[model samples]
Target chain A: MNRLYHYPLSPFSRKVRLSLAEKRIEVELVEERFWEQDADFLRRNPAGKVPVLKMGNRLMAESSAICEYLEETHPTPSLLPSDADGRYEVRRLVAWFDDKFNSEVTNKLMGERVFRKIMGTGYPDSANVKAGSKAIKYHLDYMHWLLDQRRWLAGNELSLADFAAAAHLSCLDYVSDVDWNRSVIVKDWYAKIKSRPAFRSILADQISGFPQPSHYSDLDF
Target chain B: MNRLYHYPLSPFSRKVRLSLAEKRIEVELVEERFWEQDADFLRRNPAGKVPVLKMGNRLMAESSAICEYLEETHPTPSLLPSDADGRYEVRRLVAWFDDKFNSEVTNKLMGERVFRKIMGTGYPDSANVKAGSKAIKYHLDYMHWLLDQRRWLAGNELSLADFAAAAHLSCLDYVSDVDWNRSVIVKDWYAKIKSRPAFRSILADQISGFPQPSHYSDLDF
Candidate 1:
């Protein structure tokens, strides 16, 4: 059986899990504390990141690459469009969430509030938390702007862009960092995606120190 | 004419530039001070980042997405492999350089040594420089290990992974940050890639304050 070495709160891990569950691939989830840098884990992935999928002898790292690889191998419910332009938009948004949104929002918010405590880094920097809080409103507004134009983040159809976004947002939502009332369309979009069966594993995820918020798993939320 | 808004020292911009040049896609280079976040530039790309590609009416952002789109539309000199696994490796290495290498090395070294002066941010943080300098050796060793196995960074074929690695290394090379004496195989890999026609424009790049180092454009180096 395929085994996925991932952490509960890692957005990257959640992104891969969503793709796997969406594609109906069976994989045993093995929770890995990747930051500890276990020798065995390093052997599997020298990059030393989470969401390493052990498929047979092949070990895959990098969430975007893994998601793209999964889409290529399993084409059932395609996450990317056939057209180049459509595909570009999907990948673009995926980068937006993973790179821009992550650095600006998730890293600031989650990195301060959660990872600091979990990783035993130090006390949370209130200034970073403040910045992250401010940054998230802009991101939510950006999402609202995008959702106003299209049914999904990338297009009318659900794609990996949605998963990439939901992955980050879900992790933020786990810490109650997300303000769901920010945008109705954004909220509705979340509601639609959060209700999907693919999101069950993520919703069920429970980090030891961090308790899952009730609204996080609520379909109506 | 196709236009690319880019900053000379940005690895992300250089990656796109290399991809375009490798694929022989003509684009008029427009040096954008994206950090300034000019209203017009933001209109072009809300992300306010450099390396935005304007092809006809379509404006594209995110270097990885742009490169993938270029590969899709212009398949003549393929930067990616035809097979899924090969493509996965290429993307993985690309991310390895872009994400891991950037954070560990480039952002620390270049962010301090170059960007500080160029952007007028502040003085170089010595601790960051020390950490970046220390971190690069490990990356070079990793590269040496990979090159020992395959002809190129990803595989035998010269893929985008090589460009991604070269792009960062080239920028660091401009600042004399790369220690060529570290690994012969890695140096040889750089020599091969540096001699490419696609690398000519990058080699020719002359930043205002930071004069191009003697070895930067030296093919024999």
Candidate 2:
């Protein structure tokens, strides 16, 4: 059986989880306190990162690559489109969320509010948090702009792009960082994605110290 | 002909250049002043990011996605292995450099030392730069540990993983941020990649204000 070592609030881990569920690949979920730098976890990924997958004979890390590997290995319910251009769009959106969005929003807000405390880094800087809060509106606007033109962030079909975006936003939503009111289209898009059977586990994720917002598990919110 | 809008010191752009060169794809290189954010460049990628590729009729953005798209569309000399497990290993290492290395080293060091001056953000933060320098040693050690067992980063064959790791290290090396002597294996691996025909343009890269190191252009160091 495949085993996933991940943190509930990590967008990258959530992405892999969503992809596994999407492909109907059964895997054991092992919550890893990556910050602790456990010896066993380090053996799995010398990099000491979360979302490391232990498949039959292979261990893999990195969410995007893991998702692609799963997609290629398990062809049912594809998360990526067939065409090269379509695949490019999905990959671009995934990078946008994983790199850009994570850098701008998730790292700023989550890293500030929660991760800092968890890591014993320091108190959250309100300025950085404020900047993240403001920047999220702009990102939501961009999402709304994309959703306006297509059914999904990349195109008419739901791809890993949607899962990547949802993963980050869901984590932020858990900390009450997302303002769904910023864009109605984005909200509707989230509602649709959240309603997926694959997302049930993600919605049920609970961190010991951090309490979920009232609307985090609510599909209609 | 394909055109790449890039900055010499940008690791993301460098990764794309390395991939293109490895695939034997000739591209007209256009040095983009991402700091200036030209209107024309913005049209190419509204995010106004570097390493945007204008290939044939398709305009692509994001280094990771562009690299994957290139691998799919131009499969002649494959940068990614054919097998599912091999591909996973390659992609995982790619993400290690692009995301983890970028965050821990590039953003903290380069963003402070070089990018801040270019973007007029402020003077370089010595503390952040020091932290990045310290963090890079650990990352280099990790790379050495990975290379100790395998011929290349992912495995025996030279893959996208090598390019991804080299791309970031090259950028840091440009500003004299990397201590190459820390790991002989890592240094040898980089030297092997640096000697590649595709790395010629990257080695020849010149930024006006930031001068290159003595070994920057040397095939052998």
Candidate 3:
């Protein structure tokens, strides 16, 4: 069995978990205190980050890499398309969520509001929070624009791109930071993805100190 | 000829350029002012980012995606390995460089020292620069550790991961921000990669008003 070192609210970890679940790969979930930088965890990932996967003899770090590994080894219920161009689209969208979206929305909003408090960095800066709030609208609008053009963020078929976007949004939703009403397309897309059987574990994730928003676990939400 | 819309100093663009060079794919380079958000460029990528690839009738955005696409379509001198596990390792390292490295080091250092001056976001924050400078040492140490174990970043073979790391470092090196003496292994590894013919264009890159380091183009440096 594979073991995953992760944090409940981390979108990167959530993205890996979602990919594992989608591929029907079983993994033992081990909550890691990444901020603390535990020795054992450090051994698993010298970088001292979450979403590290211990699979067989290989200990892998980085969500994108772990997800792609799972997709390649499992090959069932494929998360990436077979074609090169199609695969490129999926990887691009995944990068978009992990890099751009995380920077513009998740890190700014969630990092300021949640992680700052947890890490004892300082109180959340209202100005940064407000900026994050405004920035999210643009991202959500971008998602809507993409969804309007295709059935999924990448194309007409479901791919890892959707999961990547959802993972980030779900984390934001946990803190009640996401305004689902911003875009009907994005809302419907989330509803479709969240209702999946694979999403059950992610939906059930509970962090002791951080209480989830009321709508976090609701299927219809 | 394939056309790449990019900025010479953009790490993401540099990653794609390195990958194309490694794969021996010839592309016409078009430097894009992403900050300008030109209408034509925006039409190419709704997000208004580079490096975007225009290949025949198909236009693609995002560095990871473009690299993957190139790897698939041009399988000669493969950037990724044949096995699933090997490919996973490569992808994982790529993500480490592209996402974590970019966030922890590149964004902090480059955004503070270079981007702020270009965007006129006010004077560079010494605190941020100090933090970035400090953070990079940690990242360099981590890279050195990885290089200690493997011939290349992902494994025995050169892969996209090396290009990703080199791209980020090259951008910093252009501004003389990288402390090459921090790790002998890292320096040797970079020197080996820098000596490649693929790195020639990157070495020659010049950003107006921002001069390159004295050794930026020195193959033997």
Best by DockQ: 1
Per-model DockQ = 0.91, 0.85, 0.77
Tens digits of per-residue lDDT, candidate 2, B1-221, equal 99998998899999999989888889999989887978988889977899999988888999989999999999878888889888988998888888778888999999999999887888988988888999999999989988999999998899999988999999999998889899999999999999889999888888878988788888777
lDDT on C-alpha atoms for all candidate structures: 0.94, 0.91, 0.88
User: Considering summed lDDT, which 10 consecutive residues are worst modelled in model 1 chain B?
Assistant: B113-122
Score every model by TM-score.
Answer: 0.99, 0.94, 0.94
- Backbone clashes in model 3, listed as residue pairs: none
lDDT of 3 by residue, B1-221 (tens): 99999999898999999888878878999988889888999999976899999889999998888888898899888999999888987888887887778878888889988888887788888887888899899889989988999999889999998999999999999888898899999999999999999999998888888987688888667
Ranking the candidates on DockQ from highest down gives 1, 2, 3
Candidate 2: misplaced stretches above 4 Å? Answer: none
Q: TM-score of A-chain in each prediction?
A: 0.98, 0.98, 0.97
Task: Report the lDDT of model 1 for residue A216.
Answer: 84
In candidate 3, position B183 carries an lDDT of 94
True-structure Cα RMSD, model 2: 1.9
What does candidate 2's lDDT look like per residue over A36-149, in tens digits? 999998889887888999899888888888899899989889889999999999999999998888888999999999999988999999998998998898899999999999
Error of 3 at B91 (Å): 1.8
